[model samples]
Target: METKNMEVIYQKVANILVEMIPEEWEKILLYAEVREGFSQIYFYYYPINQKQPVYSLDIVDVFNIDKTLHRKLKQELYECFEKLWNEFKVQSQEQLASLTYILDNMGRMKLNYGYEDISEISSEEKQDKWEAEYLV
Candidate 1:
């Protein structure tokens, strides 16, 4: 694939991430370039308190660029976005207890059913389940 095409895809991914995590939009930084005939993309999100930036997320080793992987990557990116959005909402509501509970339960859920399967679970259901398990 051409570098321009890869850059477009990278931009799309970055846009999706911003839309999903609006709170982190200002904090997020995206960089993409072609190195050695391969596309390289980076995602960085820095917190307000942190002096040094942190590399909290990434998608590396992207060699074979195709439509299938592009679609799958978009889906996976959205799944992660939804999860992060849910976490942010819970945290904003001052539901620390519920947040922790959900994190733990979601980890188990991921372990049992896998991340792809967990994506099928609605955001509301996730929130409700966490509330039931911990907030109540």
Candidate 2:
């Protein structure tokens, strides 16, 4: 997957988040994955502060994004995957794209935490570790 597309998606999401998140939310981690034609396109957000354990919530509710905006974001996700398929298919001898293109990028302003592949670490474990290291 192209890093540019990921950056764009992150930026769009962050722009909306900036207006909605409370001042207490020191940082927010976004986990997005697209597997099997948007069937697994789950967007889970973990809002963190130094005083509390990291917790997950659906971003739409967390940010109070309405259905129209949610649908637009979902469409953007699908478009991104389509772009990936188009780019990858040409590079393959079989002329078929891989089904394992999942986007799980995490960024919060100047702080960026690298995520392990899905097979390596679960999102809950990452939240636990973050809480242990950063929270009171």
Candidate 3:
């Protein structure tokens, strides 16, 4: 996908997150720009800190170069999102709201150069039924 398209998609994903967990909105931060032909996208969430302005949360970085990578990146983004959503669903409304507020304001964070990959065992591999599973 094009850099412009990737940025648009990233924004949409961020908006979806904002809508789902409005209280945690402050924890969410997005920094994306086009450099050369690639779109460098960073998604972050920070903990709350009233005294100091800056806080840091987890960050996911992706380089979107084509439709395949774009799709992969979106899939990964949603998986993490789902995990957080489920966790928040069990919390009180007030607590949820507070968390969302912290997420929403996570601002001006930058990406580091090094990258790490998160790996998990495929369900099929775990079950020893490769044919029954769909590849991501």
Across residues 4-34, which tens digit of lDDT does each residue of candidate 1 receive?
4433433455555444332322254433222
Q: Is candidate 1 or candidate 3 better by TM-score?
A: 3
Candidate 1 clash pair list? none
What C-alpha lDDT do the candidate models reach, one value each?
0.36, 0.43, 0.34
Off by over 4 Å in 1: 1-13, 19-25, 35-37, 56-136
Query: Which prediction has the highest lDDT against the true structure?
Result: 2
lDDT of 2 by residue, 21-132 (tens): 4334545543333333532233223344354423333444545556676566566655654554444444452322213221222443432333333434565674455446
Off by over 4 Å in 3: 29-114, 120-136
What TM-score does each of the candidates earn?
Answer: 0.27, 0.40, 0.28
lDDT of 3: 0.34
lDDT tens digits by residue: candidate 3, 25-72: 335543322222223333344335532222222212222234454556
TM-score, cand. 3 vs. native: 0.28
Distance from true location, Cα of 44 in model 2, Å: 2.3
Sorted on TM-score, highest at the top, how do the candidates line up? 2, 3, 1
Single out the weakest 10-residue window by summed lDDT for candidate 1.
105-114
Pick the TM-score winner: 2
Worst 10 residues of 2 by lDDT: 96-105
